[model samples]
Target: MNDFLLYEKTGGVVILTMNRPEQRNALSSVEICEEFEDRCRSIERDPSVNALIITGAGPVFCAGGDIKKMRDRSGFAPAKTVIDTRDSYRNSIHRIPKALYNLEVPTIAAVNGAAIGAGLDLACMCDMRISATHAVFAESFIKLGIVPGDGGAWFLPRIVGYSMACEMALTGVQIDAEEARRIGLVSRVVDGAALMEQALELARRIDAMPGRTLRLTKRLLRDSGQLSLDHHLEMAGAFQTISHETEDHREALAAVFEKRAPSFSNR
Candidate 1:
């Protein structure tokens, strides 16, 4: 709905492109945050959407927060008082991670260029990341004399491990795509020209599965990180029961025996 972000849905795969090349796709304001949150909600409600790929429109993925807005005390920057600033963060930027974390479908970040500060955290929030050869990343909040107030501490450590997260955060150093892949920050790195094609190819492969099953699988994977093995087993059993009863499951089995392509109703 907004020019800052472009939403394109093809069959069951959704691609959200941060469309502010002039501003380097900055996470500039609360309005932009709301746009992301709203689109996430829309994807969750749409049964046909099996996967999501987020990328930037132009050269840079995102520049993090807007320095101009920060200096002027506008957008999601400091407010008139300490209490208001805290409330602002909770009300504005925090919505992104919450919305993304709770989304049912699988999500991927296609890092075409630089992803810094909040931008890096945004990529970390996704289920997977694919980076271009020229991509750059930095947990640069410390460089700005601040910390990641938008849940970077939690997500970054989960993606890149505690020690590496500390190195990135404390040092505010940038890493290239190859280094990101070496540290497992990104799953794959391709040429910048082929980034979207590869990302969409992966997404389409994911979309070929039964929709309900895909969502359930993603839910189990996300929950397993925070859950005890025993608890996860119980939850997995419940999810399996749901999957077992679906029409798609029957079709999948029938196709295997018949040696034919399965057509799913996504039930």
Candidate 2:
């Protein structure tokens, strides 16, 4: 929308780029929060946009919050200020994790470089992730003498297990792309220059899929987190019912029977 953030729709993909290259594309200032949310909401509202890819300009993805701003705000230390800051982080830039959780379309994070603190949290929100081999992830909040305020605490443990999350949070250690792939933090990693190439390639392949199934499957996965195995199996049956009834499913079945490639309408 503005220089701070930009969105471009191409085919079934919506690319949301963080535009603060001078600041490593960090979402530090409060000015762009509303704009950021509005753009993301627009993406959600578009049924034609089947996937969302978040990345930054320049080399680095983000370096987390503005340290100078944090230090300046620390002098007050009132409970209300602390609460408001936390809320601001969530409502503004850090809510991607939560919003992506409920998004009807799949989301991906193309990590071009360092993703520290809130940047890492943003990655964890994506349905899948691709990163440059030169990219790194850092649980850097502890280095600033604080805990993971947004979705980092929840996402890290689920992604890499509790022990790893604890170690990463407490020590603020940075994990390279290989380690991230090993620990399941990322789906794929490639050369720095090839990061977006890989992400776009993958996005294109997935965008050609049955859109309604992907959306419902994403919703089911999110719901499975809170349900028991038996209950989830029951839920799976319910989800499948919806999936099989889509017009896309009918087309796919007919195509298979006719020995032709399925032309999906994503109905």
Candidate 3:
């Protein structure tokens, strides 16, 4: 059977693609959500992979949750069907971002085209985003008479500031890659065909860096966002103490003093 989400391995990076191009790759079918989440979970099975890139096949990223499919139900209440779809989308995450959130690695979203509704929320899951110049983001839920589900409201405010987040949320605006970059929605915007190339280059650069420290830093940053300064310092200090004892840390410090590149084996 063809995979709804395609998985590819590149060095320390895992690339995941939404494989349904026929419907602009929308997660409208219930089966697609299950399949997509399965692929995401499978990618996390590899220990050597340190980062991930999520994109979609075809010219469009995802057309939100499959609005057409959900609405086509013969007699189901429209609102109830939407709520069901929202639940499915929430469950489809496979606890992956929470893993990515704590995975001591990074994730990048190479938004190649329009990222709508749940699609836009999916992009927000990553730690970084690099999109095609023509990519668009739509917070389209309000137009459908439903609220943004799947963490869009949560991630947008965190990354772009409350004021900007308020504007995006209230307007349900479709932002272009340039505007996305301007308001911090994405980190970089490249030509359509070059999005993945640039993302891998970035993943390679990140993968080449120290893995242990990156993990520790990820934890530190997560804590910093919620913990008080003293609490965060205490957390970082604990991590630093544990980190300094690692052989990789010793090698990195020694290499820094000796004026040579540090060879890290994640020891």
Sort order, lDDT high to low: 1, 2, 3
Q: Against the true structure, candidate 1 has what lDDT?
A: 0.94
> 18-107 in candidate 1: lDDT tens per residue?
999999999987888889889999999999999999999889998899999998898775768988889999989999999999999999
Candidate scoring better on TM-score of 1 and 2: 1
Question: Which pairs clash inside model 1?
Answer: none
- Compare the candidates by lDDT and give the number of the best one: 1
Candidate 2: the clashing residue pairs are: none
TM-score of each: 0.98, 0.92, 0.86
Candidate of highest TM-score: 1
Report the Cα lDDT for residue 251, model 2: 94
Give the per-residue lDDT digits (tens) of candidate 3, residues 1-267. Answer: 347778888777888888888888876654565565555565555556677788899998877776665577422123456677456555654343454454446788889999998788778878889999999998778887877756678777888899987787788888899999998889999999888899999988887776767767877876688999999999989999988888888898899999999887765
Query: Once superposed on the true structure, which residue ranges of model 3 sit more than 4 Å away at CA?
Result: 29-45, 73-102
Model 2 C-alpha RMSD vs. true structure (Å) is 2.3
**Better-scoring candidate (lDDT), 1 or 3:** 1
Q: How many clashing pairs per prediction, in order? A: 0, 0, 2
